[model samples]
Target: MTETITFNDLGLSEGVLAGLRAVGYETPSPIQAATIPLLLEGRDVVGLAQTGTGKTAAFALPVLSNLDPYETKRPQALVLAPTRELAIQVCEAFEKYAAQLPNIRVLPIYGGSAYGPQLTALKRGVHIVVGTPGRIMDHLDKGTLDLSELRFLVLDEADEMLSMGFAEDIETILATTPEEKQVALFSATMPRQIKALTGQYLRNPKEVQVKSKTATAANITQRYLMVSYPQKLDALTRILEVENFEAMIVFARTKSETDTLAEKLRARGYAAAAINGDIAQNQREKTVNQLKDGSLDILVATDVAARGLDVERISHVVNYDLPTDVESYVHRIGRTGRAGRSGDAISFVTPRERWLLKAIEKHTRSTPAEMQLPSVDEVNATRLNRFDEGITNVLAEKEKISFFRDVVAHYVSENDVPELEVAAALAAMLHGEEPLLLEPEPVRPQRQSRDRDDRNSERGERSNRAGAARTNDRGDGQPMASYKIQVGKRHKVEPRMIVGALANEGGLRRADFGNISIRPDFSVVELPADLPQEVFDALAQTRISGKLIELAPDRGAPNRRTGERFQDRPARKPRRKD
Candidate 1:
């Protein structure tokens, strides 16, 4: 619970303590506290911890502390990670924690980028090299990376590496290293492959497992708002207007999205900036410093860029987009609710991502309470309250108000207006542009059915269909409406493709659809009668394989009696005038 701890307890060097302080690391995490001592004793270590548990420091601290700064840079430390993202993250951590050690240099090598920079870094001699297996193997074969003098070899996220099919590559890299090298393997889980590797490579390793705390912070309140994509931005703006957050971090999935969302927030008058992989390191540090110092109120960032970032002033964490993994969700929310401080985490879950939200709740073992979108009246009430507070504070302060009073008098006289009119004009000016807040569209909740037999019967009929043509009835014994898409059998579209696209874009559950009829020209999907507007809007925006829905009504024989056409009229051509 405390951030500061004695490095002597961890058996680390004074120089390492100095370096840690330089990087603002006041204490060690549970994993770091247990593994650092054993690693500094020159014994192999096996650490089991989840992501964002300070696993990097668990290994990096001891490895850096034990290394002789005067030793020749022949790659004394080698760290292997699963992906390019993880490799870069570990290398950055090493660089930050070792900032005070002038002789310490770290290099990250990974694919999907150029090899020129990596080759240059290796040739210049680095004290530590963190890389992915494939790229590290490539460097080894090129004779560009020399690990014969390696004193420490670390396999970060060993389970993920194995899952990514890097066992052979790992073996090759380990074979190239010195047999007497101290090895440390860390993973979230120890599958059989990882255990076998440990038995073969690590010699009498000290095992350290840090179990996750079962209880989250009670002071931290969690809630989620069900919203459609078009309404999420509006909902977020409304929340920010009402919530009294000191500083907040909004998490998005991609770099581009972070930038875009930050710009939108700034346009709405909130002090905001984007922090992503594309931003320079210095700029990222400056942005964070500004947020801490109260110059900025909102920071939009992707997960990778925001990792290991601890800011005590962060009062809220908004998940602008649901994370793809449960681990990511934990890390995102962990940014707030620190040091016994109460915080709030709000997630906007679209209908399609409801399953992911459920997964997160199950993984965290804490269900987030659902909330409705804030109404316009609520936002206005909050604004009015803030205005009254501002006036009260001004009255309480011992500041000069004669100048403001004179200006108001002058304005009233020049416009030949009443004092109240002058005040109203001032308020309108203060509100700035876009004063009318838009109301968010409502989202309907999923329906629950208790009839298992009827549900299974409908599912069986859907599964047994052999062709792309079928008319299906709902589990409730009602005929569903069917619509055809322009793309069909010739488009190489499968029933599952249609199903997934609909589920993802249309926010429709798998049960909402009765059957999929795929054909050469297009496909037909069955839906409940009188579908909600939100569902219809989502379908209109759905894109499958680079094609828009372009859906027209499917007036099959069943609907002929209703006088409905099978296809809607095409867009009218403008009068072909000269």
Candidate 2:
């Protein structure tokens, strides 16, 4: 077994040690254990670890051990992050670790905030500067940020920065910093570009990679619920009410969705908060702290905004919206099941997003078990149990209730009512107007049925056999309505792409679509006859090869005898397909 090391053994300065103790940190995490010694020696280092692996402290503690708070403040240390939220989070880590160290100033510079305050802070002199690449470049251009005397430079989530297309900006910033400044870089995945960056920027850096024991924590129980698009919000609410979770972080796709979901949860009496890119750094910090202290129970956040969020009490992670990619799904669920604690990861998979869900399963090498929404009666039972427990606690306080008991006695005597009736009236008064239970929702058809699998497999086989030109057959010997989409051979549109996009967009299985004939300008596809207006509308608005799927005008009826094919039409410039 590896030797256990604590914060005390890491050789942190007295001030940093005091701050770590204040934060209740005891032992060092795996990344911290391997990286602290290297960074403390002023050697350039590259750390490979995920978000919740305590990489921030792994870098921050050592940098603080070398930083001189009383020294000239021309930005002694610089940290660059991909997003504003991550930038603010790193800056806050510095502040917390430097709490006992006097005169140490750390400033977070990012876009979507006033430059006046950043300029003011810069003029006042700051020891460390943490910021996003784009905003940092803007400040560097204006000469508001000075990295001349910077002793340490750190890049948190370096791969993310490159994925966000900030490689050029990052290189420019690094070039401006003094070549002698100690550089430490951390990334979850080291792509070829990142390797090149390391070779160019880092000077024989000591590499530290602390691989997770498991792709997913063995303690986490993963499950998924399939619901229609319209009923997703209600499904989430029902799950939240019925599931016993101490704390949860609901992931949404956009900033506005996070706010909307949080508002709805709060209206339903949940202690919910929203964390996003638009929220101020101080407010975001306060919300996360509230979540940690048990003042808040649920936090709705986007992927970019929840980076470096490490809260021990997060018993559940609800994917209110499925992530766009498989890596994101893994990271979102990684927020929970941390520190060897058992946790739950629940995902809401809409019919249209089934492909994405399957992608997640394939990526993680584990399929989430199918879960059912709680019944109304079950939710009601939980509510009533909690209500009775609340009253029981009140009854235990008999001495404090003597005065109120007399008032109840007076009302009962004046109204000539039984004491039991008086107690019932009190219960009614306590219960608000809203019903204690919710209405039962219509049950949706299960997506994991054997019949659904057969349908998908059959569709895949038919598409494979049909090649590029095939007739529209609904598999039941019924004719399909042929439609033309604005992508074809020149655009590199394939039948699988068409099938996948249409099936996902229309919320239909692969078997629902028919043969696709690719032409020079456009392709002809056969879908179910008389498709629902809603499905048709969605298909029209959907893009196949970065071009909208448009309805082909009546080229007279499709020639059934010769099999449906697109007529000769003028081809446009070939557009690349993603």
Candidate 3:
């Protein structure tokens, strides 16, 4: 039997392995599997795949593996994404994968934010930096950012960057980097501009192309919802409130799931029914007739039972469970947009199944617009409008509601209450214990403050599943504070880099020259009095070779860096001779 390839088989650092487990990814995507080994072997790579492919992880993982953060704290790996959103996204991915390796630091730099923090983060020493081309250029021009020590460079979405007219900026940035560094360029299409770019910058690159057969449905409007399996019902219920779908077919994977989902939908008063392989032909036909006659609003069914089932009233198709193969997905959504009518297809994908989604998109040649789960407040507003419309619609039927009006008027008089009060009371009774407005969605604890450049408040709604959980962002309003760590070192690290991490963490000027000593096992240096606690914690947790550092107190120190009394480092000279 052929050996099954997995992430475990890939030569990854333990931290990367822990990250894969945390993010719930079991197998590598085609792009990742093909590109990882080559990049890890110090070969430049060219990846050709659509957006949803696992491109980010493919390069990010290997770069993280090869980095020696403690030995050299400056930005070693730089990734240039096309936009602020993608930069933030790629930065967050780096942070997540480097979670187990607390010593490594990552930052996102872009144009809109103030430059103070970006310069500060750079000074403090970062292992990886993800940013847009424009901002990176600004830093390079200002001499605030240095790429002299850069070991790896990645041009993510190279085609998009060029389309956005970052072609010149990309070339300038590429020219600044050392020629010895490994470079990777990923793009969906290779145009002449991109071809010329690869030829000029990339050195004998190994092309890793992942192509899928084209499948198109021009008439169908496709969208995808990123929700967990348990949260699907909540999402479906809220979607039903906002959608004006006349009839929908919800596809599930198995017979039991179809039956259970149908029962749940009916319990919510959706006029829903189920059809599966086990159902009798007579009952199936009856259900189909009811759907066609408008008695059924939704039909939940297994793929096997849904075959050859067509109804003109069907306006929507929902993939309750994603199909295992591309053909299956195409066939499921194909149920709608039939004949001469246009239709909608919504697929529910769990966060971890993003790779599968990308694969489906690449095969179908249709980019499904990402969807946000409706907010409780938004749903409540929708309900209120619907309720008001219901009453206004009823009130329009003057002849039909006269008896109900008389009953309500008599109740108001009997209870000695105003007509409005009577109406409110009646609405309360009709809704029973269920509140007309749903409680708001639970808020997660805030980690990093939103950056000034944040276009959206939350992550997922604006992101493509691979998004910002806690941005490695420092707010402008935050005092330009410094952070550092103290630990007993068990492994070898460059002494200058350690001091650089300390000096930058505390925002200490180059003149803060206190004598520093370097020892074999541990090192001691004077810390800035104004160093931030966050930086202190980070320094304390930072591990070199998976071992913690020993914190050394100043002047009348207990233990000292035994190597020698280090000389004061000079200040950096001002910029842009090139």
Candidate 4:
């Protein structure tokens, strides 16, 4: 193995070196070690490295080192990221590395943030400006950003910018910059577009290429939980209760989901916060600082919001929603298992998305081990241990609790209750009405009878858990309506797809849908017999596999005229059991 290179040996300015020491950063990463010297030498370079490869420092340190702090605060260096979160992260890094340097100001400008502050900062002057391509273009069009004196220009995550359809904006902003300014472009992959842009801008650039690793870090314990759509939130809370995580980042699919999940976690007494594009820059900065200082335990965020984020305390990463692509999946989990520390990554996969899970495995060349949810006993044990620890802590603070102990003693005497009983009452008060232990889902046995009468009886008893039901006086006395959908084995329709479509489009809970029986060209599903016409209409318009769902009343029996035997029908399969 090659010898590790220290930051001191990288020839960084004394001010930058002091800042690095203050943050406990000693050695440089491979990309940093290779690119810093080239950047300091004012070479236009192209760096190929994935997220979390210390790419930010590879460029930021050298740019800051060469900055003239006493010069007129017109922006001297420009860094453009793909997303607002990444721009903010990169800007913060510049600030950290330039902390000991006087008269240096770094500003981050991004969309969804108020323009008043950005305008003020621009008017007051800043040495460095880091922003997303679109926002940077906005500034350039308005003539608010001055790049005439810019000595360094960095394009971080160039590939991601193109993926987000910002190529035009990027090119427009690049065209506005001075031709003499030194430029650096960093990206995980060099696609044709990025290559074309580099060819157009960079002049005989030095290429520092770091091969992408397909597999996840070996130090990360990767696991997946197969769950239904409805039970995912509950399942996440159960895991959080039992797993001893120092800090965690929960990745969701949308900004609304991040807000909803964060709110739910906060109601459960967790120090949780939501970080998304909608949040103001100052608020987002404060939330990140809180996470770093041990004040926040959980961060609920979307992919764009959490990009390029690095927190040493993040011991766990939970994929609340799977990404649309395999590369995104790897990037999402990459938030953890960083800084040479062992971390855990757990993903919740619904049955409909199992194919996605398999694809991720194939792409990453590693299979995630299946994990069982914590048993009720395990959860109870964790709760009891926490209660015991609380008691122990209170006992340890004897002097602080002496007055409270006397008051409790007086209450016990006045109420003529034993001290143990009083203590039990106090414990009960501390633990709220919500059950301390979760109830395991009940298991159902397979139906055995195949006779005509038995088959009819079984169909009658099927429960419609998703919608309103009317009792069938003759059978199990449950309300359920059976409907036929135009999708089956021929269409490659799976039970999970039907369930996912209904739950997603009809605004119904997972439990609303009951039994599903797939046939050659059509499938039958049981739902609350009294479902609103609006919901049923919505379901009819929902598309699966590019085919609109055609739902109608089930003809009690599939035209027996065809003489198809009841026993010849394929057995029903549950998508997943909660």
Candidate 5:
């Protein structure tokens, strides 16, 4: 068994400590506490822990500590992840942890983005390269990414990479690396493929497994509110008006989103600040310190940037965007309810993201209570109650008020306004922009019966009947009308993506949609049969997966024969430089 340890006992350099302090990491997590020591001793390690258990740090700290800075940067450490999202996340963690280590650049290379920047960064010589297997292989083939000086090779989320069919690519890449390099592998599960890979590549690896625990703090009152994308801001504002939270942390998905949300919250008069990857380390530290000292009430942050943060004053954790994965959900909620304090975790789940919520519940083995959006009346009543309480507090304080009383009397006499009217005006001024509480939109849960049936149905029958069935009408007898959308297989969209986009952007429940037929260049969707022109127009304006959707009457043309086959489409024209 590995001995228990602390961050100080791990022998990390002062530069790493500075980075850790900037992020408020006072102690090591269980996984980090266990795995760092062996890895620091230059032993190959196989770590068994789920995401969000600080696995990144378990390997990152040791790698940074053992590296020789004076050595040429031909990629000393290489981390391979399955997806672009995971690759970026791991790179971000390394960057944040190694902030004070000058000349130790970390780069992430993935598809769905330009490769020029990645190539440039590689040519400049980065010490660590975290990337998806395909893109990394591309660089390796092109002679852009050099691993000649590599000392450590880490396979993060090994099971995920194998599931994504990167086994051959991983093997090929590992074959190119030097035999002297230390190998570390981490995975949530030890599947047969992962085990096989470990047996083939690892050298007497030290195994460290964190027992999966389904323990969530009893003090946390977890709840979730279902709302559409546009209504989310309004719903969140309403909740802020009603809930009496001391300090809160709002989690977003990206750096831009954090800033956008923070600005919106600030405009609404909340003491808010954003913390994301783009912010400088010193400024980020200052913001967190201010929040701890009660000067700032809310902090908006992304998951990677918020890692290692521990603040006792955070009374609530608001997931502004539902996490992309279960591990992220666990980490986001874990920000609150620390140090034996009771806290609240509130998530706003768009209809499309309900699946992710369910996944989180399955992984955490804890369900969040469903919460209804706060009504306008509820918010207004709470605001008035708070106002009254403030007045009471002011009155309770022993202070001579003769000067204020004289000034108010004079103003009332001079303006011929009632005392109540004067007080109301003052309250309005103090409240800033007149409080216009929004009416909460009615939330209808997505119907999962069809989805459940689809999952259980035989593949052959489901594909054959894809275009034949029609969804049941509501209380009315009219069958929903079928309309053709301009995007389909050519757009590389799946049924779930289409469903999620519609539910998120159009504010339509899953039940509102009927049979969906995906074809080469277009799709047919059953919308409300007698939908008003406004609804049709709204649907026309909707964009899904970043493609504008034009709605037209179904031509009764077989969806399969609508347009050019997806595989035969003309090559995309390259863009001109500005």
Candidate 6:
């Protein structure tokens, strides 16, 4: 029989070991067990593991063991993540694992943050630089970040970077790093592009694959609830009331939605905060730390903003809006079920999103079991039970409750009032003006049959939801109008870049987009006919892949679109970069 290998058996340094022990890491996960040794032995490694499977510690531990904390004059290691949140997460993990080494400093640099602090950190001499590829590339371009002394380069979530349109940036950054540096790349899946990257960049790397049943970890209990769009907030509030979750993240689709939902949750008495791309970097970090330290219990966030957000206290993840793709679903739910803890991934599926559910099931090869929405009676029962339990808990602490009990008894004796009446008055005072019970949902009339006109409208709605908006290609005669943008394949543009820009700036639902096709020097996308002038103007000014959309209706002639705002404007010479 073979014995299990622990983190102690992995030949880590005294400082790293002390730090791990402090963080309560008693054993190594499968990926860590396999990859840490190779990293410590000065070998490049390619690791395959899903999110939330301890991949950070796998490479971070070994890197910490090898680096000299006193050598903080320049960065000895660089960790690249696909998103700001992920970069922050990796940086935090490194800081936690290097707790015993006080001299070691790690700085996370990403877009949406001011350059002053990052520049100060760089000038102060950081030991480790964790940042997204775009920000790293910008620093490299500005001649601020030098990689000549870097000893280790870890590409965490390499596949996600490529999928998010960082292929060129990754290559450019890799070109700047010292050739003598050891590379450690981690990704959930190895597509052809990632394989090509490994072949070109890594030198005889040791590959380790941790097999799993699905893209998401098995520890996550995946479920879906059927609800209408208007009722989603109500359903989520009810779930929060009944669910025994310690901490949770509720994912919304847009920045506005995140803020609105967080505000609503706070109003409902949940300690909540909001995070999205539009938020400042400091505020985002503060919110995440609040969630970690138990000061906050709920974080409402957008998908991009919550990428790689890992908090051990998070026991549940609620998908308030469905992700655009299956991979996003996996990534969003992956925030929970981390380490060895169990978690719940609950998604709300509107009737029109049934196709998305099917796509998820087909991709994961596991169906999300349907979850029943908590009924009014169930919520009322839970409330009453909690009320009773609160009293019971207070009574158990006799020393604390004796004063209140005496005051109540004295009031009853002074007024010669019934004990029950005084108790009811006290309960009313405690409960305040909030209703003690929730009203049941109103029933809707069922449609027994459909006329031709009703059927046509239904078909149109289905087409909008199920067509190119979800599939990335327009169907023939889909009743959608086409618009053109100046950025395309030549500009290294991606379909999602267009979707995200329009959705965020124009506030258009994902279903509003029709067909999206990328061409050589330009790209075209389908949108609803006769869009409001304000929405068109907003989209025309939106930027994608660092280029102003300069959008124009794909009128048979190649005239200007720019939402008619730039129709008379002279065609300014195209920028070199764009």
Best model number under lDDT: 6
Q: Give candidate 6 misplaced runs (Cα > 4 Å).
A: 213-221, 224-236, 240-432, 435-486, 492-513, 517-578
Better of 1 and 5 by TM-score: 5
Can you give the TM-score per candidate against the true fold?
0.52, 0.50, 0.48, 0.50, 0.60, 0.57
Clashing pairs in 1: 468-517, 468-518, 489-519
Candidate 3's residue-wise lDDT over 185-296, tens digit each? 9998999998998899989999999975548588889999988678999899999988889999999977899999999999888999999978998999999999999999
Better of 1 and 2 by TM-score: 1
Score candidate 5 by TM-score against the native: 0.60
Worst 10 residues of 2 by lDDT: 569-578
Higher-TM-score candidate among 3 and 6?
6
The parts of candidate 3 lying over 4 Å away from their true place are: 212-363, 367-578
**Candidate 2: where is the Cα deviation over 4 Å?**
1-3, 214-220, 223-238, 242-432, 435-578
Better of 3 and 4 by TM-score: 4
Candidate 1 per-residue C-alpha lDDT over 1-578 given as tens digits, one digit per residue, 9 for 90 to 100: 85566665787778778877764566677888888889988999999987656788889989888887776658899999865556766887787678777678888886545678878877778888898776677677778888889999999988866654567678888877899999999988989998899999999998999975533456778899988778889889989988989999999877999999999998888999999878999999999999889999999999878988899999999999877556668878889988889899999887767756765675577889998877777888887788888878877765566678899998888988999988887777877765644454465544446686577877745432321123356668654666667778776677766775566545676677877788788887777654555555545634444355565445444335666533344422112222
The CA lDDT at 501 in model 2 is 56
| lDDT of candidate 6 over 482-553, digit per residue (tens) | 677888887888898777556545656677887799998889888765555656555554545655677655
lDDT of the structure predicted as candidate 1:
0.77
- Name the lDDT of candidate 2: 0.79
lDDT, candidate 3, equals 0.74
lDDT of 4 by residue, 178-288 (tens): 899999999888899999999999989999997545577788888999886778888998999999999999999878999999999999989999998788879999999
Top-TM-score structure, candidate number: 5
